[model samples]
Target: MAATVAQPTHMTRAKHWNEEVENAYRFQLAGWRDQVEYTGHKGEVTTWPNGLIKKLMRKSDECWYYFNKTRECADKDINKCKLYTY
Candidate 1:
């Protein structure tokens, strides 16, 4: 999981996808996703700032879902750039 630091794109630049990044991707259990703050959530409500991959996925997912709910226009360019964490 050690990739060279390439140019930053849709995916946030991780310092380097190492063991630490992999472990963070796994947050104990399914409920770990709840830790990420969305539109209507309490506590430390915040976007998925866990890492580059998570951040990209979360943002894109949120945008997509929001558009679905509110019928907003989606960003064609960004939407085209799918996150490839695995």
Candidate 2:
């Protein structure tokens, strides 16, 4: 049997800059709803030395979206991101 994956209980829009918000932005930019969805389609995610996402391949056309070690989600994007919590 396959392992059971827990779905997020609720989601909220990001109002500040944080790791969760940053990750949400990356996944959204890569055209995925979230990491769970990304992993379902792409398997695994790669990260930088400091634990930030290094890159993500877009599922739409197999293009890649690279990210810097620093935070990529700025103040402007905080409001645009939705964070899921289990």
Q: TM-score for model 2?
A: 0.85
lDDT of 1 by residue, 1-86 (tens): 22332332333323434433332332211122322322123223223343322321233332321111121222332232222231
Q: Which ten residues in a row have the lowest lDDT in candidate 2?
A: 1-10
Kindly give the stretch of ten consecutive residues in candidate 1 with the minimal lDDT sum. Answer: 64-73
Model-by-model lDDT, in order?
Answer: 0.28, 0.86
Superposed Cα deviation of residue 26, candidate 1 (Å): 1.1
RMSD of each: 14.6, 2.7
Residue pairs with colliding backbones in model 1 are none
Task: Tell me the spans in candidate 1 whose CA falls farther than 4 Å from its real position.
Answer: 1-15, 33-86
